[model samples]
Target: MKNWKRRESFLPVAVLLLLVSLIASACGSGANTNTAGGAEAANGSPSAAAGSSTSGADGKKEEKTEKTKVIWWHSMGGELGKAADQLVADFNASQDGIEVEAVYQGTYDESLNKMKASMDSKSGPSLIQVYEIGSRFMIDSGAITPVQDFIDQEGYDVSQLEENIASYYTFDGKQYSMPFNTSNPILYYNKDLFKAAGLDPDKAPATYGEVKQAAQTLAAKGTPASFAIYGWFMEQFFANQGAEYVNNGNGRSAPADASLVNGDAGIQTLEWWKEMVDSKAAINLGRKTDDTKKAFLAGQISMTLDSTASLRGIVDGAAGKFEVGTAFLPKPDGAEGGVVVGGASLWILNNKPEAEQKAAWEFIKFLAQPETQAKWHISTGYFPITKQAYDEQIVKENLDKYPQFQTAIDQLHASKPSQATQGAVMGVFPEARQIVEGAIEEVLGGSKPVKQALDAAAEAITGKISNYNKTVNVK
Candidate 1:
């Protein structure tokens, strides 16, 4: 009986041992399968991987490069911002191995301020879009890598770009940034109002003197002209008259230490503008271009001076109400000068990795393509930086649809390259502009004479420039 019990125990133990061996064998098989999957992944052909590899007809795996991500900080807002975002989306969808994130920080002033604060950290942008006036500050900041480096490396032909537009961003024979949105001030007038005032409907005024006459006629007919007392208009007037805004080649040849705001050209511009307001030929519409644009569209004003960037919006707003007309920025009669380029450019920052900056350059190149520029020009009223964009079919169609746009392109093309037209560059330009606007208000309110207001503005700007030079350690 004892022998039988031992035999039973032995049989149970043997069964248990067999079950453990089967489990071990199954686990080993699974281990081998997992190891094979890992090896396949290492060899760049893992089945679970997507977009990183694909099989060819030759049964070999083709590996894809990982995307180099970049961030673009821009100041574009409203409808323009939307258009910029769409371009980024299209770029991402059209390519692999590069992804861009565009973040709209704020307006030009606010965006620049934020960029300054973020310079010490890794939180800043790989690429930044800075306004024209900020060029001096950007160059002095030493936080940027000149796009010229990439241009030289790739032998990129920049002759295709608009010379006047590129000139604003060029310094010392190097293009510091890529011109994106470009514009110049232009005269926007209501053609229906012009006819009502007995002025030539198709013949817009092309000089300060002619504009004054038209304003008088329009005012007598119960629609006074309105020009926003914007400092940029002041700057444009100086350029249009072939007058420098500062000494030392309009702050291009060297750092400027004084202001030419009290020069003859400045006095002439201010006198004519103040006379129009005083004689009731033109109405003072404060400093916001938006307010003046609204007044013009509402038929309260017969004419206005605004950026060409406002062209599309102005035209669309006046649709079915009145015919809109555009003319080159008016200068003193017989002044042999042209308008300076307004708007902004794209700069690659040094805060990011070299790979990221190269990636940013790639994106900038994409933006500079004729098709992209054409779309941008059509969507926004800003000029296409590249001349080739004008050759695009959409651009041709757009010109046919909105003939007013032709004036901007014509104005840009007609401009002769000069130091004045290349625009004044000062580190304190935004502040200087504010002072100029304040002086304009003082003169318009009859609290100060034109000469006195402008002299005071010049003094103030000079002081600001001195302080800026000190901060930048520029002797």
Candidate 2:
């Protein structure tokens, strides 16, 4: 075990050495300067090329010794990508001391895998936007400098940030990363369909029982509800019932050795979900939320669950067809728990120089500012991490224009701090989520009962956690 851990720890350096040799050999003939969507240095104009010197006013190349360069790897795509790029451009234009290059690196999973390969190498990013589930791995990999270090050194004020949003990125009484785009799951229902089914159009279903009742009524009227079989939803459901996902305070107090996924909450949720699907009240749309969103927009489904970040697209897509109503993620009857924040946060990598890391922190601070956060919220439909952002004129105007978004804000504010809402931390979270998803499919496909499926998934996840702990040398 010690030998294996030693090899695993040394793998990044070995890979880096091989890469350097390959690059040197290639440079002997020619070098490829184009940057693909991976973690290589940002390739483009001189100013955007990370660490490249800029020309002085005298038309002479200057060393740019006083300036710091930061390369940011991100996973945003499409309109969200555009918004992220605009933020980088704004940041670069705001100051001459720091040159930041933002690179879109596909999905979160792909970006994380690429980062794992690039860590401890020159090809790695100075800063990266990692999804919430990757937080445990980021900390365990020892590849990131916790933002708390900078916050403590610089006496940065964090009270202005949303407490619940910030709490997700906080672990062990320290802020590991700066909260950026944050969101929670919300239930989106078609008001028109509810009215057609003789249900209240103004009031959305607030609990699992209510959702099931609504689904039944809507299905009777030829409108079905579709909740995508998302593993995130499964996690949220556990939290919504005030249940921990793993042992030891959901891995916050100590390293988790077992998954609590087969608890009463998990069984209740699966049973409720299975009952709905079994009765044809709800449709199983497989694992893609996009597919469920399409069905909702096309009026084939009346209700769906998705991240609040999808508000803009769904609202605009259903603009003329139907009225969209948003509510808190449904919970079991009398359950007091709330949704855990979704979305990603900005992390400063340790592979970079202290100056570069500081430069990345500066950018993260700028993003946390009220003005920048308000713009980000408006552009991407992501909730701003800063509480002061709500006071921004643009944010106020936006909320007034799209009142549906207020439901998300209200839900966030209503949530009280708890282990469940703070979210679970585990080194093998990505793999565990996949395992849970597979178990859901097993239950829905009648291959296994709900409790049996959950038990199997818990066993699989525990094995993964054990392997991860062993790899990380966690006792």
Candidate 3:
């Protein structure tokens, strides 16, 4: 009985250790990934030897290697997923050395959560797509080999990658992930509503104040409420106002100590927004972006703010309803800060074999190539992350057919980058955004004053930051 009891108690502890070991083996370093399979993956960069081993040591032509199957977990669905599937097929056909299989994970947040379990089992995919908001979490998890690591090892020149997109994904002066399917927030207005409201259809609102005026005019014209009450919009407004999202230079330098969001920028934006709702100039559409978008597509709303990636859907939805015009997101006080990149990126997982890593990197590079990006942008309406993609014939034809498409690209190029625009980097950002949205709801519902609601949210977020920092041991 004593021996049995001891074994039972020790079982859980042993299992926990095994799990930890598996996770560490999977993530700690891909530098040493050849303990099994009898085949040595390369040395140093793991894939280094395999990469250059197209020939043997005798200077004789080497035979073809076995196909390395690379698993790619992504959150894309619908049309985007179809495009991804086509690309994967194209990539597989292009090379006999690698076979990439694209698997659809849930949403971005769900992918992150599910990835943790797979990492613990040392069965994580070779590549995972992570959203921009998950940047800090992915870094702190240490489950990734930074893109710069592969770049330096392979001497890859990333000069073709757009700087505006790179400015967001880079951490500590090094690129962390390869930017993919990038987008920026822009204003989409109905020209028919504008004409009915006696406003110029050719010009767009350039500031928050103008948006309100346009909303008031549209509201008077029996147009649906203008704009969404989404948390992402709040973040954009703060950045455009040149307000710091958090301390420590929005966590670009060091971990953020506290949130600076409840100050002037937050108060002014939220207060005016509440006034808009109360005056019926705008309606509080709540948290879901799709609801706001649906209202606009149904012609219930005149104008809205959404990611440029949504342009294709909106265009399709408005086929015969009304003309859709897009412009840069209206700035608060017309400040100088630029906007951050939205959308996800390709992160190469560590603890994978060198051959697999090299294979995954090949696919990532192919995805970023100008021709591929041009095709992607034309199909999905997502801004091509590469500058050269804009020069492609397909992209140029798309731009000519839809002039509003160029608005987002021009806006990205014209604005100057700053700490505010680069966006806040925090492991707790997803939670913080939830809290902020809740606060906005309370203020709009008249349960709290704008400043008071924002202050309370900020204080709560500071506690979350401390806890998250503790969990990640980031100090």
- TM for every model, in the order presented, reads 0.87, 0.89, 0.86
lDDT (Cα, tens digit) per residue for candidate 2, span 33-86: 101123333332235444558788898987644557788888776667778888
Put the candidates in TM-score order, highest first: 2, 1, 3
Off by over 4 Å in 3: 1-64
TM-score of model number 1 = 0.87
For candidate 3, what's the RMSD?
Answer: 10.2
Query: How many clashes show up per model?
Result: 0, 0, 0
Residue 281 in model 1: lDDT: 98
Residues 1-475, model 1: lDDT tens digits:
0111111111233332332232122222111110111111101111123356878899999886677777787777666777888888878877876888887776665566676666655688889888787787777666788899999999999999989999999887989999888888899999999998788999999988999999999999889999887888899899888999999899888888899999999999999999999999999988778788999999999999888887888999999999999999999988977898888899998768889999999999999999999999999878999889999999999999999988998988887789998999887777777788889999999999999999999998898788667555565
The candidate, 1 or 3, that scores higher on lDDT is 1
Estimate every model's Cα lDDT from 0 to 1.
0.81, 0.82, 0.75
lDDT per residue, candidate 3, 371-475, as tens digits? 999988987788888889989999989988888888888988875788788888876776677678778889998999998999998998788777666554454
* Candidate 2 wrongly placed segments (more than 4 Å): 1-45, 48-66
Candidates 1 and 3 compared by TM-score, better number: 1
Task: Give lDDT: candidate 2, residue 48.
Answer: 44
